[model samples]
Target: MMKKLFLFFKALLTSLLLSACCELNTDNIVYIVSTNDMHANVLNHNKQIDLALISGLKKHYDALLFDAGDAVQGAPLAALSDGDDVISLMNAAGYDAMTLGNHEFDYGQNKLFEHAASANFLTLCSNVYKDKKPLLNNLNLPNEGRYAVFNKNGFKIGVFALTTVQTLQSTDYRLLNTLNFENEVKSAKKMLDLLRPLKLDAIILLAHLGCDDAPCTSKNLALALTGVYQDELDLIIDGHSHQEYVKHVNGITISQTGSRLKQVGLNVLNFKASEKPQVKSILLTYEDLLSKGIKPDAQTEELEQKFRHKQNKILQQEIISLPFTLYGGEQYGIDLSRVTETPAGDLAADAIMYALKTKISSNFLKFPAVAIQNGGNIRVNLGPGAVTYASTLYFEPFLNTLTSKLVSPKILYDIFEHSYRYLNNLSAAGTLQNIKDSGGFLQISGLKIILDPNSKPKVKAIFLDGETTALSRYDTKRKIILAGNDFILSGSDGYSILKDIPTLTEFSDEQDALISYLKHLKENDGFTQYLKAQGRISYTQLPKSVSAYVKIRNFHQQNKKLKFHCSVDGEKFLPCFADKNGLLKFELAPGDHILQIAEATQEIYLNTILGIGIKQGSNLSTIPAVELMPTKE
Candidate 1:
């Protein structure tokens, strides 16, 4: 009996040992870490996230790091070194591959070349060509825009990159002059043909085109990749729109890390290839969790801190502070043109536009009409106190340049229409009728005009160039100069109004122009009139909760000159419209509620418009403190 028991136990032990050994020899997993739209957040919180990832990755699998594109430009760091320091930091961080984002050309092609050459890792862009030859030709590196294949544990990983087609619009780098952004499908197909011969394991794409919930620059590329170009593409890491989402479309895994390197995208891919390499499964992981007691890798953090200190020093050299806090935002006030009144928006716009006019003055382009993209575009807003170099860099961090193209008047109107549509969708009040003395809406620059949200479908009048002209009466034949940042001119956010405009000339820089213009204008230290909104047209503010009963108490005409009526809602209230200053007060029941502001002139109403709801009988005496939430997530 004892001998039989021993034999049974010995056999069980052997079986267990065999199973354990087989597990140990199983195929190793390959981890690909990618980031995009870093936009100068090199020394940002994202750096900490990157450190945490390296520590975790080293313990589990073989890892390869990639920055899809837009590495420099858009932060104080990029502007400080003209991109060299960023390259150095990237090398220290152990980046294996990187591509150029459109903003990379902000300083022009020469600087871009310097950055590309300075980078320690493999710099690539299959589409960028120069002097009729591939940009990467003689550089001891592989040709531009070609995939670099890596062999790991018997699996071949082919990696490639693609930038947004719109990036070509800028002349900053002239990087695309000799190259063409061919159909992604065709390009990927050709690359696949070559990759297949290697009998590789997986194909990865580091795409810097923008992605969104709807089909956008990067999302379209993803579809083309999986559905048409190369359905076999194992994974696509995207950037551009500064959005985030991890999804599986048509068996192809797509993942994107939010902009500014707030987090890193990690995908652990399992594979098996007896014949053709096939992905068993792909798991999407992130470094955000590291904040919860997960310490970053000591070495990486130390290196990043060093770079950050250097970046801070460079950024602080030229920034200036303001004397007063900017108004508008979540509080009450007209949106468009309103930002111009604030020291923050007006000062920045004034500086930037003035720089352009001085630098690029010629017969063809006489006067420049500058547009300061709303508060949303102004990434950083300096407080009333001290403004440091870091603050300015954080605000105008994008390496956007003063680029211009000759656009037709018709196309120009289309651009306005596009902008108008976006504002409409956002429930933004454009004209004076739509403007509120306070609360959330689009913050605009330049023209002081009124938006009639209730007006029938067309633009009525436009006040600009020191003239208030009736837009509806005049023919659209007139042409005027319009200046703004690359995003607006690039026609991003559906503003295709300026897309078809031909290129007149490209300015080396508008920053200097803006600065010079401001200094010259402010020589006397006179009160330089900033842009302000004259609310002629306004969107109707509606109640948020429809389930609850809302009673309109009194209705009085506010802004006597504008003569616009605003409805007051309260159990017993005074229906007083705003005076020229746009102030109105009313009583309300004790509870949470929203004050709906609308245009009383036309029945066509704008909902959730503006105005602060009073909490019972509390705090109307204090002017109700207003605040804007932080832009960073």
Candidate 2:
């Protein structure tokens, strides 16, 4: 502890000694270097220091660096060192402080402690507590404080840190154990109350909460804080949700750097030690980093070289060649591989299913026609050229093993229903929870499941290997089926049903399985088609009403004279007219019925058959949902 204080003093003394030549102004300005969700990408970090050095700005301005979580876990380099290497690099980059990101615990509590203990910077978090004690204290590391006061030249700056409440859903519960993250908004307010009396020039919050629009986002915290102590709160730097934005609300400046070290959130304050503090924020892009004359730091280069040289032979080798690039897009701001079918996800699912079934040929386990994967499991997108082992490792670094189990067809339907709760979100709260449930969002390989967007938890139809099956058949005969993956099989996300399924066949690690599967396909010349978007999954919104509805083009509800007739099981056709709801409407016994609609001279003729039986409590969640469509479109 004394050594760190001595080093800090020495640096201060050195800066003071150089002040005559550099002439750093004490009363004019402060620059805050903010980074967030780096995820172990050191390529750009290598050039961060040069931003000040190359421009000779270091001599005039004091830079206070803070990372808003997620420095560990994600890239192969961090995974290779159990997160130790990134900490070393962060130290070399001159980080002053950082908050704990959820992924920092991916390697487990013990390793996380080791990294935190070794870091040159203080790991700050006001809301985290373990077993009635602060998490940092539980590890017996340094600080006995939540917020810190840093004196820059002649100005005093108060800084406190916080993380998102959704970290509970983003990480493994076991890793958390007794560690609890309080509501971020409450934590921020409490911290502000404590820091307000200090009379600091500026109060800064380093938060790992999501950006402006996401649930529990930092903007919510900013609004809550400034609303109580209006001008007292000056700036907020945030992360998580991996977004890029700079927002100002009620006089507080909020900024976030997107993931992968793409940019840095900047806060430049002009306080003359007498004037009202003025603050301005801007997100510096890669070009701006270079425009500022930043050059790569030599030590970071050497550290990166060490890791690459050690793993080069395997990491650089090509695994497979793809015909086209496969990418996953963000749905409602949360990236999901399961919201729709993607070529990359399909190939991954196919490879795993094929590997398990082929390796244990005709054993006791019966593999299902489709393979399942959580949307969150897939990380990287692959492309046209050769995909390397390192790229595959980066795509999926988690050590999730493939587990196979027999879930009755009934249970399988329940699993899909639970997974759909996120995809078919309606209310505001559900949409937010859906953002977290993206991890449990299921991606399939061999079935086309249609969804009704308007109805919550609706799976309109299950086209099993191109054969359409109504919800009634699945309810009648209960058949044992295959479903597993450590994420779902262990009931991690929200699937509590698979926790104790009787029979099971557990296989290799997820990355290893993918490696083996790709190799298996390559060896047999079956790799050509895996890169293209295969139509194994599909989605649709089926119209719903008291009776069968006539399909319209672009929902045109114009009052056009159209003749309508209805029949019950093709018994007889009866005349009908357009109701107030539009087109034509009718109700019959809860059985199969067909309705026909046509213009005066057969200009627009349509026939509708209600195939799916309307049973009590057998809608949406209880069973697969199907829409009533025309026999011929």
Give me the runs in candidate 1 sitting further than 4 Å from their true place. 1-28, 46-60, 143-145, 170-183, 212-230, 247-251, 273-288, 291-294, 319-340, 349-388, 391-443, 451-460, 464-468, 473-633
Worst 10 residues of 2 by lDDT: 601-610
Candidate closest to the true structure, highest TM-score: 1
For all candidates, the clash counts are 57, 3
What tens-digit string does per-residue lDDT give for candidate 1 at 255-352? 77766666666565665433334332222224233422344456666766777788667656543433333332323333423322343455555555
- Tens-place lDDT digits, model 2, residues 1-633: 999999788656544433332234445677777888777765433344322231223222457888888887655566557778788877776678888876776677888888878988888888888887767775444444478788775779888888776666445455677888888777777888888788888888888886523347787776775456777778888886567877888788888877666766657777854455777776655655455554555665565566567656658878887644555434223353655455567777776677556544353444444568887777766655788878787666654546566665566677777876655432321111123345676777656666654575476666556566644425635444454466677677878887666424444346656777777777888754643345454344223333433333322333343445544333456776653433344554321232333322111111111122222232322111112233332
The TM-score that candidate 2 achieves is 0.53
Q: Candidate 2: where are CA atoms >4 Å away?
A: 1-27, 44-61, 138-145, 212-215, 226-228, 273-276, 311-347, 350-388, 391-443, 449-633
- What TM-score would you give candidate 1 relative to the actual structure? 0.59
Residue 352 in candidate 2, Cα distance off native in Å: 10
